[model samples]
Target: MKLNKVTLAVGILLATAGGAAQAQAQPVQNIVLVHGAFVGGAGWRPVYDQLTHDGYNVTLVQEPLTSFSQDVAATRRVIEQQNGPVILVGHSYGGAIISEAGNDSKVTGLVYIAAHALDNGETEASNGKKYPNSAHPFIKSGDGYLTIAPEYYHSDFAADLPAAQADFEAHAQMPTNAAVFTANIPHPAWKSKPSWYMVAKADKIISPDLERMYARRARSHMVEIAGASHSVYQSHPDDVAKLIEQAAQNAQP
Candidate 1:
């Protein structure tokens, strides 16, 4: 009888151990990163690596920059693949994408990095008019698309990056359709979801004041990085990664 009791105790212990292991092995939160205009998913390599290294599933959405609907479709595709809740992050014009895409049922949180989180009835172009200084050169229209002036690449868009990095980014920048910027955001997701914002204090392309304004409007948990430029994800990957992690952790179960 004692032998049988001992065997049963061992079985119970093993079962409990297996249960604990399974609980601990639960999947890490998935993150879908959306890049803004003038760039592709490659721009998120640094953050992507960091998140994957830390055990999060990361998907980089390659926005078409062709139209608002296309960008939203691309973002939705990524979000749909996530196994559990997802944190959708957008940088620059990507903010607009997230604002719309965050409405997806899988997206549990949002992180806006120097992005344009415009509310209802706002377009990217209209938001720019509110600021006094157009520190960044006006985009030229060609073939129904928009391209940034090459000169503004180093001084305005990525002033804080090393010269070589800035040059490479300029060369790699993608041209977006003019119609995308003028497209009004009909429904903004931040209206219903929890959000975080990173304000690049030294950003020249988008005014720091505008960043503050957007963050305030979104009622996001805001963090200000004093010397970072518009490309905060590239310049300070660790900081951005930490914020992404926090957003993931705070996501609903």
Candidate 2:
């Protein structure tokens, strides 16, 4: 009788463990997207559309581009609104925002699309200087804010995009506070969370090498899209959405 009882107890324990693993492996249903500097969340429309069409709950955080803390706050607010575990996705400068805001308990994974993934004490400018790209010559600044010169925007920031669409993005630029580039990350969530990164090989804004370095440092699942420009998320939504979905399916809390 005692042997039968022991066997029953072992069966229950095994079943419980299997259940826990199954729960952890289930696809995360909620996704929060953060846009990089020089643009707003609207640029994520393609990606948002794809994810939503697939039945995932998706929200976009429009950072005011006022300051680092403010951007992080904006992202965290959206994260807090999610009903379940979140896959936080960031593009370009948005990467730094998620690196800080992703520490929220609801955030289970991170996705960076040609974005900066800074470490504590490191500013995006400082990090980028280590692997300089061509966009530097096109940067324009005035009254504490910075933007890419409209004439050079297409070539430097979105070469892979349609000329007309790139022109629209150039004129519709959202100038970011200069201080935003220099702001230090006090606690980068990527250090503790599982991450996925996409490297745009033809990117002229942030060097592909820098993206690779960030992905390597985070031990993230990395995907490289050859001939892609800085606006890979906008130009290639399908691939971006695929990686984000992969994270949703595989990332563990």
Candidate 3:
């Protein structure tokens, strides 16, 4: 009887291991979208709608833009909601949040769209020196928050977008803490997890060269969209969605 009991226990262990393997074979379905500074959650509407339509379990984290820690916490909260593996998608500064938050156990992969994919000790403050762009003159700062100067918002930040929508986007900008750019990442998920990147070749806010450099360093599967501006997520939602789905498909258990 003791031998029989031992045999039963061994069978259960085998079953549990098989179940874990099955879970790993499953493709990622949960997607958490993080929006960048200046643009609110509304900025992700196009990509959000398309991803949901495709039957992915999608969550959009509305980061307070208050500070770096708060943004990471907000993203983690959303990631915690999923029962299975997740693909975290970030836009612009949202990339920084995911680089920190994507370290979660449930996150299977990451997607950065025209974002700052920094490594250890590398902040945008330092990257600015590495890949300087005259883009700063278009930004205005006040009381710890930063936003695009209204006058140059359209031409400088969203050149590919319609002038009217770009104007409204500028008006609806949500200010982010200026210091967030200098915040050091404790652990960048891209270093361990698989990453995919989309570069807006015409991006004026973050230099296109910087995007390429980051993507190359992260070893991200990189795609360059010709003529895409800094607002590529809004201007070219389909391409962004495609790359995100690719990450999900390629993610290992």
Candidate 4:
């Protein structure tokens, strides 16, 4: 399996980087998180707290929603700072970013949270060809950017969230370039790394079927969270943290 091959490659890299430490045992505590478009790294606050409390060194990368390449670059910058093995995690469109950035030698594994884990040359929008996102009607575009209208954010995008909180998120969302989805993926990191995915069964932004398809195709260790919204990172931080911790532990050298 490609996942096994690449994951072993991670261990090999670890063995080569610090021979003495590999003999002593290193758990790969480093974790880098990438946020999706429209939301900033602040959305990861709850998840960060959970992971940090568990004693993992977590770094949340604030992606530039300007472009897919820019987002990938931002993620790579964070990965570059890590001294050892890392588990790269992404949410929503951030999945695409990590798909590229996780190719880095330092990355040992990947975790996708209600995200678009597309294959090589695949785009986020392309992942929806068969199972289009149910929340399309809720999305409003402007000047090459996209965002959820305040009216639809509460109902369609985050129905599981408190109405007031959903409304606030909608209002504070950063605009994401509509063109970002058109960018082609060259070498998806998942093809060469162990992957895990969380399916938000109640997500409207990206169909659950599509999420399943991607996870299955990548041979990801998949978990389904019933009634979780697109904002599962905020709504169900504990489960998200558990999945991430599992990835980190399993990826250990």
Give Cα-based local distance difference scores for all models: 0.85, 0.91, 0.90, 0.87
Cα lDDT for residue 67, model 4?
84
Q: Residue-wise lDDT of candidate 4 within 50-157, one digit each (tens)?
A: 999999999999887988878888889999998889999999888888888888999999999998887766777777777887775536465778887878887667
Off by over 4 Å in 4: 1-25, 138-142
Backbone clash total for model 3 is 0
> Candidate 3, residues 106-213: lDDT per residue as tens digits?
998999999999888899878978888656463546577888887788987889999999999889889888888898987899999999999999998889999999
Ranking by TM-score: 2, 3, 4, 1
Stretches of candidate 1 exceeding 4 Å from the true structure: 1-28
Model 2, 38-115: lDDT tens digits are 898888899999999998999999889999999999888888888889999999999999998999999999999999
Total backbone clashes of model 1? 0
**Candidate 1 lDDT tens digits, 64-97:** 9999899999999888888888899999889999
At residue 204, give the lDDT of candidate 1. Answer: 76
Report how far off residue 103 is in candidate 1 (Å).
0.3
Hey, what RMSD does candidate 4 come out at? 8.3
Which of the two, 1 or 4, has more lDDT?
A: 4
* Residue 116 shift from truth in candidate 4, angstroms: 1.0
Deviation in angstroms for 13 in model 2? 4.9
Best candidate (score: TM-score): 2
